[model samples]
Target: MTQLKAGDPAPNFSAKDEQGNTISLGDYKGKKLVVFFYPKASTPGCTVEACNLNDNFERFQSLGYEILGVSADSAKRQSNFKTKYGFQYPLLADEDKAVIEAFGVWGPKKFMGKEYDGIHRTTFVIDEKGVIENVITKVKTKDHTAQILAD
Candidate 1:
């Protein structure tokens, strides 16, 4: 996968959120946005990462950041995940992988010694003008907020 870096122009995307609302990059025009890509919905690692972000949701908002979770899951699955955890932010359902490929997070991955193509866990902090301020490829699932705040 082509890994995005800090200062790269965040690729534009328009996908449906868990609520079926169309969320586009342009919507966050004048605000910083946190776009997190996870491999799956309700998985162990994904759960921890998502909950950590949600637990600090208010703080992130206070810091002027709007969060959006993305995954190649169906809208129903995304909705279920969000509802189960009571996540405060919208989770994008990128079933078509359009957004995933745009962000360059989809590629070969190894798990338990088996190689396969999948989505990589990544987080992008986009500035008000839509430029990436930081791209966390080595994401700390439980302390992601700090990574963004550190920038």
Candidate 2:
């Protein structure tokens, strides 16, 4: 997979969120954004990352950042996860992998000696002008908010 880097132009994407609302990168035009990709919705690691972001949601907002979570799961599944966790941000259901591929986070992954293609947990911090300000490749799920705040 092609890894995105800081200062690179973030790939534009339009997809349905958990509520079936159409969300696009353009919607955050002239605003800071945190677009994170996870392997699946409602999974343990994904939950931790998302909840941490939610817990610190106000801090991020105060810093003028909007969070968006993305996964290649169905809209219904995304909705369930969001409701269950009370996430304040929208979760994009990129079932078609359109957004996932645009971010270039999909590729070969190995788990417990098993190999397969999957989404790489990545977080892209985009500036107001759509330039990537930071790319957190080595995410600390439990402390992701701190990481973003640090950057």
Best-matching candidate per TM-score: 2
- Residue 121, candidate 2: how far off, in angstroms? 0.3
For each candidate in the order shown, give its overall lDDT on alpha carbons. 0.93, 0.94
Q: Estimate candidate 1's alpha-carbon lDDT, on a 0 to 1 scale.
A: 0.93
- Over all chains combined, what TM-score does candidate 2 have? 0.98
Off by over 4 Å in 2: none
Error of 2 at 29 (Å): 0.9
lDDT of 1 by residue, 44-87 (tens): 99999999999999999988899999999999999999999999
Candidate 2 clashes between residue pairs 3 or more apart in a chain or in different chains? none
**Residue 5 of candidate 1: its Cα lDDT?**
85
Q: After superposition, how far is residue 69 of candidate 1 from its true place, in Å?
A: 0.3
For candidate 1, list the clashing residue pairs, or say none: none
lDDT of 2 by residue, 1-151 (tens): 5578998999988999999999999999989999999999988999999999999999999999999999999999999999999999999999999999999999999999999999999999999999999998899999999998896
